[model samples]
Target: MYPSSLFQALLLSATLVPNVFAQSSTTTDPTQRAELALSALQIWYNAGSGLWNTCGWWNSANVMTMVSNLAKHDSGNAQLVNLATRIFANTIVQAPAKNPQPGVESQSATKRSNGNETYDLFNSTGKESGYYKMIGEDAEPITIFPKDWDKAEYIDVKNLPIMQPKEQVTTVAASNPNDWLDGFYDDDLWWALGWIGAYDVTKDTQYLTLAEGIFKAVTKAWPTACGNGGIWWSWQKDYMNAIANELFLSTAAHLANRVQDSDKAFYVDWAKRELDWFTNSGMINERGTINDGLTNDCKNNNRTTWSYNQGVILGGLVELNKASPDATYLPLAARIAKAAISELSDSDGVMHDACGPLCGGDASQFKGIFARNLQILHDAAPDAAYVKSIQANAGSIWDNNRDEGNMLSINWAGPFIAPANASTHSSSMDALVAAISVN
Candidate 1:
C-alpha cells in the first residue's frame, strides 16, 4: 500500500475533461481523450487492492459513468466495461459490513456550551490508537493512526485525547455511529458521481437508485454547526473539519440534480448556506486563502491554506455552476484557483503541502489539490492560459509524485489522511475526472 498507479493513470482524465476548443455547434473530440484517460484508469483498476489502493472503487465508478455516457460517442473505451464491472464488485466487497469506528472520543468529554461550535477527537500531538492501515486485516478502532504499522518515535501514537464540548459532534448528533465520517463521505461523493456518470453513459435509472441510497446516508449524517448545516472540520474541531461542508454541499447538489427530486431541497439548501458561511467567516486575509477551520481562523492550529479544502470547494462550485450558473460561486472558485497557483509554489518549484503561518504536512498532500486546481481552471476557463497552466503543473506532479511501487503511496495514502489536512483527495479525484470529461 505504498503508491497507487491508479491516480497516475486516471489523471489522464485531467487532460481530457476540459474542452479547450469546443464550439457551440460542434461536437468535441472525446475519443482520444477518453482513450487516454481510460488507459490510465485501466492500470489503476488492475493494480488496486481492497485497501491501501481502494481508489479503484472511486476511479472505477467514474470510468463506468464515462463509458456509459461517452460510449455512444465513438464507442469510447470499450475495454473499460469489464474493468469497471470488476472494480464495482471489488468496491462492494471492500465496503465494511458496518462503518469502522472513528476512535474513542476524547478521554474527558466536555459538557455542551453556548456559541461553542467545535471539538477535538485527537490531542495536539496528532497521536492516537485508531487503525488507519489499508490492509484492513486487523480489527482495531480506526483513528488518526492504526495499531499494526511501523512507528517512528517522532510519530506519537499514544497521547492525550482532545475534545471540544459534546455539542460539536453533529453528524449523528444524538448517537455516535462512527468517528469523523471519513470514508463514508468518500462513499457519498462517489455514489453521486457514479449515478451521474451512469446516466450520461446508459440513461439507466438503477444507478440512480444506488446514488439515492448514498445520498440518504449522507443527509442523515450531514452536520449542522456554526449556524449553518455543514460537515465538521474533523472529528476534532481543533484540527480541521469545516471543509467537509464544502464536500457535502457539492455532493448534495449532484444528488439533487441527478434525482430531480424536490424532496432533496433541504440538502441542497443546507449546502448553499454552509458555502455562504464558509466564504463569509472562514476566509482569512485578502488573498482568499481560506482558513483550514475555525482555529485556523485565529492564526492558530493549522494556520495555512490547504489544497484539499480549495479543491473540494472548487469542485462544488463547478457543480453549482451547472445548477445555477451564478457569478457568486464561479467567481469565488476562480479567485481561489488563481491564488493556489500563485501562493503554493516556491523557487525550487516545489509545492508547500500547506500555506500560512502554521503549515506542515507531507509533500504528497499538495499534489491532489494542485492537480484539482489545474483541472478546475481548465474546466472553468479553457483558454491558453488555463490549458498551459494545467499542462505545466500536471507534468510536474506526474514527474515528481508518481511511484511504480504502488498507487497507495502517491494517491491512497494522502487521501487516507484527508481529514487531518482539510483536503478531500478521494472526493477531489472524482471532481478531477469530471473536469477531464468536459475537455
Candidate 2:
C-alpha cells in the first residue's frame, strides 16, 4: 500500500549512519557506478510481458515505472526507451477491467481489526480457500509471475509471446478496477504513483490525467471526522494510518507540481492542507521519525514506523518546496530522512521496514520506495551520505540478498529467507537504479 516504484522503501537515512553517500562520492564516477549496479538489475526485465518479471499487478506497475524512470535518467541505455514502450503497451492492455475472471476475487467482506491489515492475504500452501484466493485478498485471482522467471527459468518469453497472464487465484490480490481500491486506500495510491511515473516518462497527457483523476477521486475520502485530518487506510473507512496519508500528501504535491494550468492550484492547496495538518497531527513522534497512525481516539497510535511510511513523504515535501519554495519543507524532509537512515536500517545500513521477513505484498514493496525517495532528497538537498547509503545497499543486495536466478529477497539483510516475489524484486530494483544519482 505505498509508493509506486516503492516509491516503498525511500524514507529516512541521513540521521543514523555516517555519510555513506559523502564517502562514496570520491570513488569512480557516480553515473558509472550507478550504471554498473543498474546493469546487473537489467536481467530482471522481461521483454515478453513488457514488464519486469515481477508477478503481481501492483508490483509490475511499480517495476514498469521504476524501469521507465531509470531509462529516462540512464544515458547509457538507449534501448530502455524501446523497453519502456513495450512495457507500457502491455501494462495498459493487460490492466484488469471491471469484472474479474471465475474463481479470482477480492475478499472485502471479511471482518477485521484493520481492513485488509490484520491478516495474511493468502495461505502459505499457496492453494485456494473458495470465494477467496488467499485470505488477505479482498478479491479473486490476479496474475503473478513466479520467482523462477528471474533465474532465466523461462527466458523464451522475452522474444515470443511475452509472459502470458497466468490467472493466479490461489494467493493473489484483486486485479480489476471496480474493486481495485478494495478498501485499501494505499493500494490505490500505489497504482496512482505508477501512473504518475508513466506520465513523467512519456509526456503522455493521458497518464498524467489518469493519475490526477485518481487523486481527485481519492481526496473525496479525506474525512475530517476524527480531528485527525488524514486519509483512511481502507475504503472501509475503519482506520487511518501513516502510509496512506503520506502517500496522499506526496502524491498531491507531486501532481500539483506536474499538472497543467487549470488543476495545479487545487492539488497545491490539497498538499498544503495535508502537510500542515499532518505535521501537527503527532504522527511524527518524538523520535523525529513517524509512527503508524493516530489511535481511534486520535492520540498517537505509536505503531512501528515501517520504512515505507518514512520513505514516501519526502517526495511530497521536496515537490512542495519547489512549488512553494518554503525553507521549512526541506528541513522537515531532512530531519525525517536522518531519522530513517539511522534508525530504520539493518546493521549493514540497508533500509528495512518494521514488518521483517513475514511482510507480505505491501511490506515487500517498502524499501525500494525508501531508496528512490532518498535519492530524490539527496538530489534536492545535496546529502552526499545518502549516496554512501545507496552504494552500501547496492553492494549488500548483490552480495547477500540476490538469488541464483537474480531475484532479490525481501530482506536486504539476506539469506533469501522469504517467498521471493515481484514486490521484493521491484523494491530492490528501486534501490539499485537509484544508485546513479549519487556518487
Candidate 3:
C-alpha cells in the first residue's frame, strides 16, 4: 500500500481533492486530447526542417510517426499524410562496407589511393565532438582540414599508430551522458513498436515483421551494447543506468505481450525486480516524486526525480496492469501520476525544476519529457480534471518553447512530436490513436 501522506500531498499541491476523478468512471475524451497532441506535432513539423533532413536518429522519425498516426485518426487532415511522407523521404540508411579484394596489387593500390584520406573511423572529428566516423561509410566531415580543426589535435594514420592523442580523447570524454543514452539503442526498439502501432491501425503486417526483426536484434544487443540487460544510462562503458533498464523493461514487456515470447519474460522479470528494488529503496519518496533512474547497487546515494522516470515507468506499469490486472498497481500508478503533475510539474506544465543536485544540473532543462509523461498519463488514466489542467498548461508551454523557426529542441520542446519522434514508441501518436480507439 502507498503512504497516505504522499497521496494527501499530491492532492494538496494540486489544490484538489484526493483522487477526485476516481469518484467518476468516464475515461478522458480521446478526440480533444489527440487534437491537442496533433497541434503540437504540427508545430514541430513546420519548424524542424534541418532535423528532418539529418535523419536516422529520433528527430525525424519521431515527428513522422506522430504525423502518420494522426492521419489515421483524423482522415480529413490531408496535410498530416504529406508531412509524414516528407519526413520519411529524408532518412539516411548508412551503407555497409564491402570486403576489399584479396590480391596484393589491389590491396597496395587501395592503400595508396586512400593514403590522402586522414580520418580514422574510430577517431573524433572534433566537429560533432562525441560522434565517431564510420571508416567506409559516406559520413560527410565538417572539419577534415588542419585549418578547420577547432584548435583540437588531428591524428594521422602514419603518426598515431599506437593511440589517438589526448585532445581527441578529451573531446569524447567531455561528451554528455544524456545524449549517449538517447542514441544507445538506435531505432531498434522504436522501429518495432512503430511497426506494431502502425499495424494496429492500418491492418498491415509489414510493421509487425519490422517490429519482430528489430526486437530480435535488440535482444541480441542487450548484453554488451546496453550492458547485460540493456540497462546502461549513457552508453558509457563504466556506469550502469537504472532508467535505461526501466525503458528496456517497458519496451521488452510491450514486445513480449504482443508476440507472446517466453524469452522476453526474463527481461520482464528483471524489470519487475529492479522496479521493486527502486520503490522499496526510496527511489520513490512518500510524496511520490520518483528519483531519477538509479545507478546499480548504489543505495544511500543521490537520486532525484526526472520526468522521464515518473512517466515512462508509469507507462510500463500500465502495460503490466493490462497483463496482470492488479487493482492495487493502477491506483499506485495513479497516485504517482498525481505527484508527477503536482510536485514535479511546474504550474505551466513543464517538469523537474524542483529536483536536487543528484538529479544533475540539467534536471530543470528538459520540459519535453514532462509533456510526454502528461501525454502518457492522459492515455493511461484519462481523468477529466487532469486532462483539462494539462491541456491548458501544455498549450502555453508548447508555444513558449517554440523557436523562431518554429522547430523545438529535442531536449527542450520534444513532446509535441515526442510520441512519434523521441523514442519511436509513437507515444504521442499512440495516445492519439488510443483516443480514437473505440474498444
Candidate 4:
C-alpha cells in the first residue's frame, strides 16, 4: 500500500535510503537553459549518422521527439529545425519507419547499425517483426528464441512472424530478470507516439502514414485475454501495464486528430473504446491516481503511483475531448493533472518518482513525458498553476539536475548524482523543452 500522506511517504523514503547526497547548484532559465542544455546534448550526436548516437535506438527516438518539440516551440531556434531535418533524412536505417541495411558486417555492427538494440532485438514482441539480439556493448547479434524448446513464446529465426507494414518491432528480450516484454506493447506505443511527434513536426504524410499503420497494428492486438480491453505488454501477454494502455488511448486520439478525413472515425472509435475500458479497468485507484497495472489474476496489483502513469492519461483525455468534443474528457484530464501536481510533487513542486536514484533504462524516460503532457494540459486549459509548475521544474532542471555536461541524471526534485547517459539526458530534455512551449 502507498503512504496516505506525503509526510509519511517522505519519511519512509528517507529512512529506507542507504545514503543521501548534497544537492548540486547552478543558475537557471527556461528557454536559455534549454538551449544551453541542447548544446551540451549535441555532444552525444554521432556525426557518422545524424542520430543521437550515444543512446539506444529507442531513446534516440525519444531524443528525436524531444528535438522536434523544441523546434516547434522555439521557432527562432534554427538549429533545432535543422537537427530534425537531418535526423529524418539520415535515419533511414532506423525503422518501423526505417530502412533495412544490406551489408556484410559482424553481428555487433548489424544491431548497432540497425540502430535498434535498446531492448536488444528487432522482433521484441513475438507477434512483431525482425529476429535477432545484440549482446552487451560489443553489440554481438544472436537469435532471440533459443533459451529452451519448451517455452511457448520462443520461436526460431526462420519462423519469424509475418508483419504488416506498420508492425515494426525493435529491441530484444533480456534473460536477466527474464525477457518477457522487451519489445513491450508500451514500447510500440512509445514508437508510435514518437512517429506521431515526428509527423507533427515534419507535416510529412509519410510520418503520419507510418503512425497510422502502427496504430492499426496496435489496435489489432487489443486483447480479450485478461479483461478483454487493454493491450498486453508484449506477445508473452502475461501482465498489462498502465502506461501501455494510456499510450494506446493517447495514440488513438492523437491520430484521430491527425489522420486524413475518412480514417478519422476508425481511430476516434478506438480512442473511445480504449478510454472507456481503461477508466473502469481498476487501474485507477481511490486517490484518483493510476496504479502500475493488473496482476496475472487481473486484479489491481496496487503498484506505485508513477508520475508517468498520472501524466499520460491526462494527455489522452485531453486529446480524446479534442477529437470528439466530449464534456467528460477535459475535466477528467484536469482532475488527473491536478492530482499529479498535488500528490507526485515535492515541497518545491518538481516531479518525483520513487524508483530512483537510478530508475534503469525505461523509467529514466518517465518524468519528461510527464512534463510534456503537463504542458499539453496547460495549453488546452490555460492554468496558471500548471504553467508555473512546468516553468519551475524546467528552470530547476538546469539549476539542480545539471551534471558535468548539463546532462540531467535522474531525480527531478534533486540533489543530482550519478553519471549522465543518453537516456537520462534526452528524457529530461523533454521537460526543459516543454517549458519553452507551455506559455
Candidate 5:
C-alpha cells in the first residue's frame, strides 16, 4: 500500500499543478496518456492483497487485463514491461488471500425460508426493548433479534443475535491456494481471461495453467436445466447472466487457440456450443444488443443494455472466429459493436451508460469493456468508425472526464467527479490502451 500521507500529497499537487503533463509535448500522445493513466491507477493498488482497492472481485481482473494489454501495446518500452511483470507476479501471489467462500450468515433474511413469515426489517416498528432493524455498511438490513425472549433480556442491537433462516449451508472449497475461484462464476471467468491475457503478453506457462484451472472449475457450473446450456452466473445457479456466459465463451475460445492441437478440439467444441446456446438464448434483443439475463421462464428479461454486455460478446466472437475460422463471427461482432456505439454514445459520440454520472461501482467498468472489445474486433476487421469512436472516447476521457490528478471519472464526457477509484480509473485506462492499440 502507498503511504497515505504521500498519496494525499500527490493528490494535492495534482490540484495545484497546472497541467502536470504540460512539461512535454508528448502529453498528447496516446502512449503517454496511457502511461499517465497507469501511474494514477497504481496509487490505489493494495500490494498486500494483490488487488486494487475500491473495486470488487471481478474489477481487479479487468485492471490486470488492462495492464497486460498496455504491456503488449508498448512492448518496446522496457520500463512499462517491467512494471507489468511486477504487477503480474505480485497479484498472482496476493490475490488468493482476498478470495473466500460466501458464508450462509451473509445471506439476506428475505432469501431464507421461514414458513411464509414476512419480516419487513426495513420498516418494522418496535418498542425500545424489542428487535430493531439496523443497516449494515453496504446498506443491507440487519435484523437484531432478542437473544433470550423468555428472560425479556434487553440486549443492545450490536449484542443481539442476527436473525437467520434455516437453509442448506453454502460452502466453497478452493481447488488450490493459487486458485482465485469465488462464489461467482463470472468472477472466476474474469480472472481466467485476465491470466490468459497475462500469459499472452509474458508467455508464462504458469499463467496459462492457472487460467486453464479456472476454466475447468467454472465448467462444473454449466447448467443442464437452462435448456442444457450456458454457465450459471454463480454457484447458486439462480441467474444465467450475459456477462458470465460471454466470459465463458471468450475463455473457451481463447484457450482453444493457446492449447495444443490434441487438446484444442475440446475447447473449440465447448466454445462453439456456448456460442450456439447464447445466440439462441433470447437474451440478445432485436436491436443487436444484449439484455442482462433470462427470466424464470427462460425468456428475455429485457433488462438494461449494459455496455459490457455488448462488449464482452464481441471479444468472445472474435476469439471463436480465430479458433474455428467462422466467416460469420466477425460480422456478427461488427453488428453488435455498431449497435452499441449508436445506442450508448451521446450527441458528441462519447459513450455513456444508461445510469451515467453515477453508474455505481460495477457499471462504471462497463464502457471500457466496450472500447477494448471494439478494438479487438477492429483489429480483426478494420473499420474506420470503430477507430473514430475509440479516438473520440479516449480524447474525451483525457480532456473532459479526467481530474487534475490524472484520475478518470465514471463519465467519459464532462466535468470530473470526486472520489474516482480503481474501477473508474481502470475502465478509462482501457480506453487509453485501446486507443494505443488502434493507433
Candidate 6:
C-alpha cells in the first residue's frame, strides 16, 4: 500500500514552493528516491488522456515501462502495482484519441496537401505507391492517401484516407478501441515492450496478449527488400535504424520467453534471424557502440552514438540469451554496455548524451533507456562496473540533477534545469529503478 500521508505531503510541498523541498534534500535511499521520482512523474499524468503531458506517444510507452519496472522492483507495494494496472487499462482506452490530437491530424493533412506524400503501409495501395512521408513530428499518426490522387489539388482534410483498422482480439480487455497504429514502427515496438514489462510485473495475460498483438502488427513491416531481413523504422522505408531493429529483436526474444506454444519456435527463429542480420548489418561500429541506423546503401550511417541506440540492444541481447542461451550473447551485451559507459559518460562517470543542454523530448528519454537495459544485462550477468555506473548515475540524478519538485533534468550530471517534463522525469526514474534493482 502507498504511504498516502507522505505522498500527499510531497505533492503539497511540490505545489507550494520549488526550493523548499530541494533545500531539505531528498532521501538518499535508492528505493525511496525511486518512489519520490514516481510521484513527481504523476504531476504530468493526464488521467483523462491516459498519457502523460509534455511527451510524445512513444515516450509514454517508456514511461509505462519505467513505472512497471518500479512496480516489479517493489512488488510488495500494492499501490505501485495498482498504479501500473490503472495506467495499462486507461492508456489503451484513452491514448488513441488523445495522442494524435485533432490538431496533429490537421497538420499532417496540411503537410500532405503540399505534395508531401504520407502513406499508411497498412493500406494496400499506399504500400504499393510508396509515396508516403512522415510529418515533422514525433510519432505522428500516419494518414493514408489514395494512389494517383491529385497532388496539385488540396486534400480534403475532413476525408483523409484512414488506415486499415486492427482486428479486435477478445482476450485482452486492454485492447486499443481506436485500432490506431502510429507511423513509426519503433513507437509500436516501445508499446510492445511496455506491455511486456507490465506483464512481467502483474502476470496479467491481457498485457502479454496485447504485447503479442503489437509484435504481430510490427511483423508486417519486415521488409522483403532490405536483403530479405530487418524491420524498417517506418512505413516510409526511408532507412533501417538501430533502435527499430533492436526493438524488433527484443520484442521477439521477449515473446519467445513468455509465450508457450508452437509460436515459440517461430519467435525464436525470428529473434535469431534478426540477431544474425543485425550483427552483420554494420550498425555496431568499431568502438562496439551502435550508430543511429544504416545508410541508403544498407551500411552504417555512422551517426551520433545516441545513448538509446546503445541501450535497447542490451535488453534485446539479454532476452535473446534467455531464449536461446547463446554463449556469446551476454558477453557481447556486456562489452557494448561497457563501451557505452566508456564512450557516453563524463569524467565523473555520469551519463550524458551528445545532444545535451537541450536534448529535447526524445533525447531526454534516451539515457534512462541505457540505464534500464544495463540493469537488465546485469541481472543476467552480474558486472561490478555496471552496478557502479548505475549507482553513481542514480546518485547524481538526485543530488545534482533534480529540482524541488523532484522533477529531473535532461542532464543527469548536475545543475537541475527548469522546465522538466514527463520524458526527463521518467528517464531519470529508469535510473532510480535500476539502482534499486542492482543495489
> Weakest 10 consecutive residues, lDDT, candidate 2?
7-16
- Compose the digit string of candidate 3's lDDT tens values, residues 322-414: 655567666777787778778764555433344321122123223333444445556767776456545544343334333322223232223
Q: State how far residue 44 of model 3 sits from its true place (Å).
A: 8.0
lDDT of 1: 0.42
Q: Rank the candidates by lDDT, best first.
A: 5, 6, 4, 2, 1, 3
What TM-score would each prediction reach against the true structure? 0.59, 0.73, 0.53, 0.73, 0.80, 0.80
The worst-scoring run of ten residues by lDDT in candidate 3 lies at: 94-103
Which regions in candidate 5 have their CA more than 4 angstroms from the true location? 5-20, 23-26, 102-178
Backbone clash count for every predicted candidate, in the order shown: 37, 44, 7, 6, 0, 1
Q: By lDDT, is 1 or 4 better?
A: 4
Model 2 has a clash total of: 44
Off by over 4 Å in 4: 1-29, 47-54, 95-183
Against the true structure, candidate 1 reaches a TM-score of 0.59
lDDT agreement with native, every candidate: 0.42, 0.62, 0.40, 0.63, 0.74, 0.74
lDDT of 4: 0.63
Cα deviation of 416 in candidate 2 (Å)?
Answer: 3.6
lDDT: the better of candidates 3 and 5: 5
lDDT of 1 by residue, 18-66 (tens): 4412321132232443334333333333222222222322333433444
Winner on TM-score between 3 and 4 is 4
By lDDT, who's the top model here? Answer: 5
lDDT, candidate 5, equals 0.74
Off by over 4 Å in 6: 1-26, 99-172, 176-180
The Cα error of candidate 5 at residue 66, in Å, is 0.4
